[model samples]
Target chain A: MRARDVVITGLGTAVAGAGGPETLLRGPVAGGDDPVTRLRGPGLRYKDRATRLALCAARDALADAGLPEALDAPEGTEGGGGPLVDGLRFGVVVSTNWGNVDTVCETSATIHRAGYTATSPMLLPNTASNVTASWVAITHGLRGANVTLCNGPTSGLDAVHWARTLIAAGRLDHALVIGVEPVNEPVRRLVGTGGPGLFDGAVSLVAEAAPAAAARGARPLARVGPYARRADPDAAVAAVRADEPAAPARWYVPEGRPAGGDTGPAGLPAHDLSLRWGRSSGALGVLQCVAGTAELARTGQAAALASAGGEGDDGAAALLLLAATAAGAGA
Target chain B: MNVLVTGMGAVSSVGGDARATFAALAQGRSGLAELRGFDRSRFRARHAYEIDDRPAPGTDVPLRATGWLLRAVAEALADAGLAGDLTGVPVLVGTTLRELRSVELNWCEGAPFDAARLHFGTALRERFGADRTYTVANACSASLYALGLGTDLLETGEADTVVVAGVDTITESTYGLLDRVYREAPESVRPFDRGRRGMLQGDGAAAVVLRRGPGAPAGARAYATVRGVGLNCDAYHPSAPDSGSIGRVMREAHRRAGIKPADVDLVLLHGTGTPLNDEAEARALGEVFAGVPRPPRMTAVKSMIGHTAGASGLHSLITAVQALHSGRVPPTLGLDEPIDEVAGFRLAREPVTERGMSLAQVDSFGFGGLNAVAVVEKVS
Candidate 1:
């Protein structure tokens, strides 16, 4: 099967912002107020914070994509079957470094302190990294290929890579890609010192095949292009440049580093979402991608995302290029 | 894209390697035993399938889980006849709990923290020197996801040879979580049996060396070809299996493999001995094979090896490959009386022989509604 062009059709954010994507692209979102606490659903009271955050972000992403609320039926629908997207064809891919770490820690602590019987069955499912993806699928009725990538900070990049691959393979027409992390005690402890920049948030984007986006009259946010991972940064940049010689107009690099010399177009305006959003580990890359897509949507230019330190000291790196599409013009 | 399984290795309770594990399965020996691998004084259900024949502690790696993975990788490499250094081979390891036990113990002891020692991906890269290493933590079906991802890596021209592994140690956290989640039966894990209790946790690791070809060289054998992969979520519940989704995934796998349900010769089930899962899976099998003239035979390995969590998928895949290679289906252990609803599908109560094997399916479903199915065929 020939590979089709994969485009981002929608965007949503639950990271430190109550107003969704706009608030995320703007400044801070009301002092890091958790969007999960505000989420409401059946049996949601028992769900952990991370699952709630993921669901809320998915809901917002579907709405942003002009799709109906996945969980809610339209007023005049019969048998409650009016959904904007095909549930079986729609998919979800989520990335998280320490998924529901707080729940795991607390559940283990409960068993240690109060005994095994005291551990809640409700909390057991959240212990796995894939549960957030599961909740998104279950709550939103996305029955297509569901996957969770846990490669630390670069996981979002991998998730996006896999999502596009699935769409290209014609397995799924659309995929909801999410990167989420919540500020929990365990994460704080693991990160050490309760780090100053550590924060919690979720980022979600709806990636669709070109034909599907065009048929739905959906506005394409950006055209995904040239994704590769390399052990050497020089090779990674070179590969990206070779794929698209124009070199991205904007860049998202690792925090605190001056972007130049093999990283991207020299002296092009660069931004670091990790620094502003606080290190969310797996969610960092998605935040960066969303920032880039937003930049492309806003400025009619392409953006490049690069990350160093793939597998500890292995010198592994990844570079992803996103160019603005005509449909995403003047957003 | 032809994905060849050139070599297979396993560090499981049934055996220290794939050969021994296959032998034990053929002999109908069970590996479920009382938990002695860790301190289990506070727990009510102490039985688990922990690897008893462990190599002595090594200085090069810190975590015992990593050691198991290294052993499996070495065996896989040697089995594949790959000599010299594998410096640039891509490695992907999947686990439900990625060194969380180390973190929990170290935190309890208030010891100095080193994330590399506990991070599975970093640990494997540091030990094996792979060019790229990734960790997949999608609960029980994670290794299947890794298998698909590894196959994708090969098909997409990322690497020629890829090492895919799945390992999870029986940690206190995992045990505690299971203990709270279900009622444990220490005597045995009996899937599809009327008197069955819940599943018993297991610890193990498996590695499969995959190459982008139809078969391997002389003397070195190719076990099977990964013909098709289909992974999806239940999208119904967090910990419960959805019958519709299960059937959909199986049909998808068959569709991708260019076969109908009737073409499947055998099935490796994710029969975890839980009532909810067993019934759901049975209904799914019935649904998918409803119109088939000859439904496939199904067997559960967890009944013998216990549920190995993330490693369960690869472990069962190795077993399925062995079945295809030997032309004999291993019996579903402890299934005294099979559940009537799925009886028409034919559970392998005893070792069954076949003249020649072709295609089989291995199913793995996880806690978070994560489901993966792979259709593998004996290289013709």
Candidate 2:
């Protein structure tokens, strides 16, 4: 069977200091209720900050996609009386670099300083790296393929590609692709607070087959385009642009790595999200996609490209996002 | 678009390489011993399945798991007959406590460690000149998830050859958590046993070189054909395995493989030996193979190697593939009285040699109810 075209139907954000996706453009704003508090229902006691932020973003994305029944359902009901979507066919792919590091570091410290007796059994489940993704699945009743990508800088884009792959393989019809990073004491100790600070929350996108979205009457924000991963910035850009009829109207480059010279398309306007939102690590790629969707909605642009590569990164990844109106035009 | 396992490598408590590990399993050699990597006086369970021949720590690779991964990758590449520069081949690593031990050392012992080593991409790039690497942390089911991703890459024509690996080392944090969770740790892992205690931690790394069958070199050795992989989340509990989800995933695997449940010759059970896990798995198996004239015989390598955390899936896969080739099913050591749920099922208590085994299924379920099942067929 031929691969199906994947479209982004909904977007959500639980970013610190930013009220909404539109607020992301104006740069970081301070002071707001804790993102964790944005989550509803039980199962919050033992969850780490990353998982809570992911739940918030996931809830928003599902609601934005017009699938609020997935959230409104009673606890344990996969999807409560939803005619539009089936929770069983929905999956989740989460990308995070230092996910739950705070829990891990603290738990280890507790075991080290006060011995094993001092540790709490409730907090032990949070130490697993995939805990955040699992919580997102459990909370929302996404019973399909659940995967967590902890790959370095490009993980967010990788998560997007993985969702597409699953859809094309008929594993799931829809997926919540989330990119989250929590900046806390453990993160500060690990990377140090020097460069482009740390991103404190999460961003998510609801990706599904174009036909599925159309059947559900959901508006497509953008259609996923070609993706490429290469060892260097130039090759990655060139490969993603190889089959495109025209260069992307705008580009979203990796954090701390500005677009210039060979790193980006020559004349296209480039935006570095980290400059305003801090270094999101694994979340940068998805954040860039969200920004691209916003640009498409704002200016009616034809296409946009989001590229990721950073210091100590093994390779670079580039993903193209075509405007929804141009979805029929083959790349 | 056939995904073939062209090469295999493993380093575990039982042995340092895939061949040796399989031999040890067949010989009923147990790798369990007193846990010596860290101070075990405080914990009630002092025993674990740990590798004895650990390489000396290097400044470049501070994390012990990274060394095991590199060694496993080397063996896999060599086994696949692909030597020298692996420039464009993508590497996918699955792990649970990736470099967390290093973090523990740094935080607790004031050891100098670079946080960049937390992910395996940098180390892989430095060692193999790999252009792209993905580190998946799907808990214990991580490696099978990576395998599924690699299969997608192959089937989608993304990459001709992909290296999928899973590696983990015993860390104080995980050990302490399990030690605390289990009221009394069994001296040995006894999967599917009536008196099974809880699971013990293990340290290991395993890798497989997957290639598009048509593109593989003529006469290249193919261990098994990856027919299909089924992945799902129970979305139920944080630490408990849901039998319904397990049964569903197994059926999904069979569906994707275009085969029936009865086609599977041998089943490599997740069989963590934890009361909840073994019971749930047995129930799932019973439901999945309810109508089959002859149910597939099952074995749990963890009964011998202990639970290797994220690496357990790949360890089980490598063992299953080896069993497919050798026709010798490894024993699930320390299982004397079988669990009631597995009453009629043939649980390999001793090494059994049977010819003409063509298909095998491997099951791996992890914390947070992450489940991954793979169906592999013997390649002629």
Candidate 3:
């Protein structure tokens, strides 16, 4: 199938000490304090730490997109103003490997220690991964289909790809794609300590259809190119390359992995997002995609983002092409 | 785009395979029994629809749920006539409690737990040689969402064949949460009934093999064609049902399928047996069919298997397809009093065998108000 034209209009991220899209590009800040204080709101206190982290990133993304702050108004209320986009047309997709694992363990402990009756009813929502995305939707009044994906590391990219598909299919006009992984004692003890690094927080991007975005006069950060996922990284890359013969100026590949042996005909320079941003289970792909979009918008250089597939990786290999300007304009 | 279901499988308390499960459903077999698998001494809800026996030829993976999923997948593969070597096929798994046993066992055994237990997709990939694996954790409706994703993959030509499954085991956390949050009848689940108290946790796994486009071989019969999928968020409360979203999703599924409410021959209600959920769903169905000539025949599968969590959606879908195939609507297991029935809709109390059911609709409402609906048509 031919790929449709989709654009990335906004980006928001909260990783390590970084708090927004701009901070994300510059890399993590020191101290690694959580942004809960900055992102607190009415219903946020009841949410788990992971959900709070995602909520902060999601709020930032909507704000960056120039959407109406009224979207954040509580349900059944009009605190802020009119909504920016039609609630039904706007959707959210969040990817997390171990969604709110911390809360799950805590609930289990409560059940064991104090008995089931002592467990908080409020904590029940946090145990599921979809609540992470649901909180964003509920807070933003996004009535569009909210989806939660758990495809390991590739979850972020897969989410982006799915969002792009929904827009291309005309199912949604705007989609919010986020990848989050919150640091918790339970996950650390399970996965074992030590890797390149572990960062908590989330990365969110706003994908909008060309016509809808143009109608709103939203400046495009980058035009999305052909995207594909396959078992073989080489095949996936080749298929994407075949769609866009022009080599990108730069490539953002996952750390510790290469895009097969070929660097395309141009042998474009490649950078590792994992090494630069530190390593974590989920949100790696979203971080790289966001970083690639940033580079394209700043330098007007076409960038290619590739994530190699692992044996058990939920996401196989995804080749996302981004251009500062539109790549297709055939009358 | 039309996606065909070439194969299907199930591992539930009622039966081991899809056929057996359907047979039991048709015969009105109730899987609800005393919760023997776990020590429910402290819990008020002592009875559940639990899978007591281990999967035949179980492994040492420490997670019974994972083993159940494997067995269901193998059965689905064999049913689809593609058993051996699933090298590059994309596999999508939807579940609520993924590998809960692994965590519980590890926590019980004390410190130094394997972190890999946290990643269910990776664990599934390692066990089953699927080139790509996707784990959907969107609560009760997760498996339905996975089915929708599989449909998207096929429609986009991303993959020729995709395997989608939903599996969830009875875990203490799930039981505890249900007991604490939505306590009704502590021992049984009676969906859509006036006496419906609350849902009983059920252990089950279900799988379906989807192929892109139309025209399966004449020899290999397709169960049904997945015509349209609708997904939407309530954006209301975390655990509360959003009647507006629920109605919209059902309408959206019909709209996507290029059909009206009248085209649906049957409706598989999410029907969790919770008072709020049942009332909301009933209201949504009424609003959706207010303009239709007649409402579809509706029944709740959870009445038989209890609430299967993530697998609940697929479990309902499987039952709907079988209902369409066999020209019968299985009785809703304890739905003697139909309090939530809408006008023009027939709630199944006895097995209703009506031929020529071309279209069926299945509803799945996950926790956090995640609503998903699928419209499937029999493709003869």
Best-first order by lDDT: 2, 3, 1
Alpha-carbon RMSD, each predicted model: 3.5, 2.7, 3.5
List residue ranges in candidate 1 displaced over 4 A: A1-3, A17-32, A71-84, A194-196, A256-265, A308-315, A326-331, B52-62, B83-89, B111-113, B117-119, B155-159, B184-186, B214-220, B291-294
lDDT of each: 0.75, 0.84, 0.76
Across residues A1-331, which tens digit of lDDT does each residue of candidate 3 receive? 1236678888887776775565555667678776766774576667876787787778777778787644546445654424446778888888877667777677676777777888877777776767788888888878776777776666777778878877776778898888888777876766555655666778888888877776677778887776666665656666677867556776666545634333532376766666556665667778777777777777777666656455544336666657746554220
> Could you tell me every candidate's TM-score relative to the true structure?
0.92, 0.96, 0.92
| Residue B281 C-alpha lDDT in model 2 | 94
DockQ of each: 0.52, 0.71, 0.55
For candidate 2, report its TM-score: 0.96
Pairs in clash, predicted candidate 1: none
Window of ten residues with lowest summed lDDT in model 2 chain A:
A258-267
Question: Considering only N, C-alpha and C atoms within 3 Å, which residue pairs clash in candidate 3?
Answer: A190-B115, A191-B115
Which residue ranges in model 2 land beyond 4 Å of their true spot? A1-3, A69-83, A258-265, A328-331, B52-61, B214-216
lDDT by residue (tens digit), candidate 2, B252-348? 8899899998898999999999999999999999998998998887899998898998889999999999888888999999889998999889787
The better candidate by DockQ, 1 or 2, is: 2
Candidate 2 — which pairs collide?
Answer: none
Residue range B110-168, candidate 3, lDDT tens digits: 63445555445555556665656777787899899888878878887778889999998
* DockQ order of candidates, top first: 2, 3, 1
Please, what are the lDDT tens digits per residue for candidate 2 over residues A1-331?
A: 0238898888889986877776666776667766777666765777888888888888888888777545326544565725556666788999998887887778778876777887788876787899988888887788888889887888899889889988887878899999999988878888777766888889999998877787778888888888877788778888888899856888888778744333345667778888788888889888888778877867778899888985457778989998887745222
